[model samples]
Target: MKITKQNIRTALWVTLSVLLVTLLLQNSANVNLRFLHLRAQMPLFAVIMLSALFGAGILWFARRRR
Candidate 1:
């Protein structure tokens, strides 16, 4: 199978879309970490969205040469 720009773009879109939906459904969940007595509660949706955006940007930059 040959990999192409269109294939990559489509995969990225699908992945991001799935992440977005998953986050939306699990927005109320809270994650806890214990380190030096520091606790943080964050919205999962925001994290997923940001991650997806960053991934998209990186993918675009990496593929610009092709």
Candidate 2:
């Protein structure tokens, strides 16, 4: 299987979209998971944007190396 530019773009968009939706749903529903005595709360939009930015940064770094 050959990886093309279009494929990469499509994958990136799909991943971002899914992440955004998940984050929004989780935030709106007040979803929370606690382990031990630690607790965390994040806004849906913030989480989604941060994750997407992180992913894009990593991808950019990888592409730059090649």
Candidate with top lDDT is: 1
Q: Point out where model 2 deviates above 4 Å.
A: 1-38
Q: Model 1: runs farther than 4 Å from truth?
A: 1-19, 30-41
TM-score of each model, in listed order: 0.47, 0.44
4-52, model 1: which lDDT tens digit per residue?
Answer: 9999999997997887787778786555544587776666666666667
> What is candidate 2's CA lDDT for residue 36?
97
Clashing pairs in 2: none
After aligning candidate 2 to the native by TM-score, how far in Å is the CA of 62 from where it should be? 0.6
Give me the overall lDDT of model 1: 0.76
Q: Tell me the deviation in Å of residue 47 in model 1.
A: 1.1
